[model samples]
Target: MRLLTQLVWVFTVLAILLAVVLLFTYDVIKVEWISFMEIQPSHRQMEDPLPVPARSIPIEGPVSIPGMLPPENPVEADEASIARGSELFEIHCRMCHGQTAEGNGPIAPFLANKPANLTSPIVQSKSDGSIFLTITNGVEGKMPPLNENLLVHDRWDLVNFIRTLTIED
Candidate 1:
């Protein structure tokens, strides 16, 4: 009983000494550190008003996306093109878009923004051109620019793959 009492007293004294040291030993104490909530270029600041490089012929010839076709010629979606697009989608898009194109892939939870549910009717309503543009340029918070990672043909293929996600009522 006496030994236990002595041990308790020793611990109490040590804790008190430590608390006093921490209180006085520091030359300066800051309650909070300076921080920045947002530290990136805004959308307006990043926008480019200048004209981009002129277009060249695509490898497979004129392709059509729903909203982006030239007024004179509208190309139809071919089976071969869609098949190619599916291949590219599996290779580059499956990891984030899911193997079924459901937008519930393994990496979805960790992303700063959720991937779009491509199967939605609203997305399906968009023209192929709009889909192609989104694939090429990406949505501000949802997708990333895949142009560098994928060739122009591959991007077209991805557009077709997105088309396949639309369920016909």
Candidate 2:
């Protein structure tokens, strides 16, 4: 009887340990020794973000449908907006578009397709919306789309700054 009782206790302890291990293995329970490194699914920054439903319009405005006319610039070309655009342009565009916005940037000669002179008559003649679209989507095989790098308002501000370039010419 004594041996049998000891065996029963051992089995009970073993069963509890197995259950705990299974629970952790299956993620039924989570234990984090380091709080910053989350072990939960979909929580890490490197992990793919949660998916949005299809056809969901962004809260900011309508999506710029390709082949359709570019959206109007909602951001006003005020001093602050233009100033911000100038700063952003210098950081993101000056290397390729040049200090004068003349497409003779330091790297222009190295590229297979030279950057467009933003202040050229052809570019200056384009509608603000068209210029905005070009900035957002970029010219295929020539320029890269800046949509990912810049926010919508920032792009509009860039448009304003580009307008200033034409004015300077």
Candidate 3:
């Protein structure tokens, strides 16, 4: 009887200890160890970000439809268009393509693949449509696509500006 009583007492203590431990592990007791990561900003997986900026999509139509030939340059390369392209180039392309589009921008050195020489024959030989498509869909890994960053008209304008860049011998 004494042995049985002892065994029962030990078993009851162990069961109570296990239950208490489970309560904390399962968060039943509300005791939690806060982590530093919890305080930092985090985005949930597959969470949609803010809606695309206004005018990002032109009402006219899509700039370049895939599986088809590159679209022709719709925006004329007039002085005004060139001027706007110059300004956009300075703001966006200058960081990578440099002021003269010579692939020697201040940030070019840091990139794994150097920016292409816009004035080179290899670049100039391409059609205006090809250039526009490149800007819309960036050279993978080497450059980021400007589809969302620049309007359709602006891409054409930039392509026009690129045509004017020539190597000064």
Provide the lowest-lDDT 10-residue window in model 3.
48-57
Tens digit per residue, CA lDDT, model 1, 27-133 = 34434444565454434655654343468545655444446552221334578878888888888777787877777778888887877777877678887767776
Model 1 lDDT on a 0 to 1 scale: 0.70
Q: Candidate 2 lDDT, tens digit per residue, 1-169?
A: 9999999999999999999999999989986667654655554566655565788765666648767877877888999999999999998899999999989899999999989888888898988889888887788988988876788888899999898875445
Model 1 error, position 129 (Å): 0.5
State model 3's lDDT. Answer: 0.86
Tell me the spans in candidate 2 whose CA falls farther than 4 Å from its real position: 1-53, 167-169
| TM of each candidate vs. truth | 0.54, 0.66, 0.66
Q: List clash counts for every candidate, in order.
A: 9, 0, 0
> On a 0 to 1 TM-score scale, where does candidate 2 land against the true structure?
0.66
Q: Which stretches of candidate 1 lie over 4 Å from their true place?
A: 1-76, 166-169
Better of 2 and 3 by TM-score: 2
Candidate 3 Cα errors over 4 Å, as ranges = 1-58, 167-169
Relative to the unseen true structure, what is the C-alpha lDDT of residue 6 in candidate 1, on a scale of 0 to 100? 100
Leading candidate by TM-score: 2
RMSD of each: 12.9, 6.3, 8.8
Model 1: colliding residue pairs: 65-128, 65-129, 66-127, 66-128, 66-129, 67-127, 67-129, 68-129, 85-157
